[model samples]
Target: MLSLNSSAMYTGASALSALAAALLGTGTFWPIGLLYEAANVLVAIIAAAAIRERGAAGH
Candidate 1:
């Protein structure tokens, strides 16, 4: 049997959750995956903007 470290296990669990979500939701798996990825990117952009704004404010 193979072993998974903590981070790898967490990542594996996340992937399984995404697969289940895609399978049970409406539409195909591909679209759901795309939407999931898009949401991640949107969040990343928002977080980056907030971090930059905070740094500029000097606090």
Candidate 2:
């Protein structure tokens, strides 16, 4: 099911963002923390856009 797969991907992306936030809040790994946070945000935005497009298409 494409919808199911898309939902999983969106959920995974959100999890990544949450994990990055947790790591950043912990105040450790300064350099890598910034990188992960940026990556998470990017992934989340892309995932959200994909989900939106799928929804618009009636998927």
Tens digit of per-residue lDDT, candidate 1, span 1-59: 24557777689669868776867676566766776787689879989999999999996
Query: Highest lDDT among the candidates is held by which one?
Result: 2
**Candidate 2 lDDT, 1-59, residue by residue in tens:** 99999999899878977776777777887856677778779989999999999999995
Off by over 4 Å in 1: 1-27
Query: Which runs in model 2 stand beyond 4 Å of their true positions?
Result: 1-28
C-alpha lDDT values of all predictions:
0.77, 0.83
Q: Tell me the deviation in Å of residue 52 in model 2.
A: 0.2
Provide the TM-score for each candidate, comma-separated. Answer: 0.54, 0.50
lDDT of 2: 0.83
Q: List the residue pairs that clash in candidate 1.
A: none
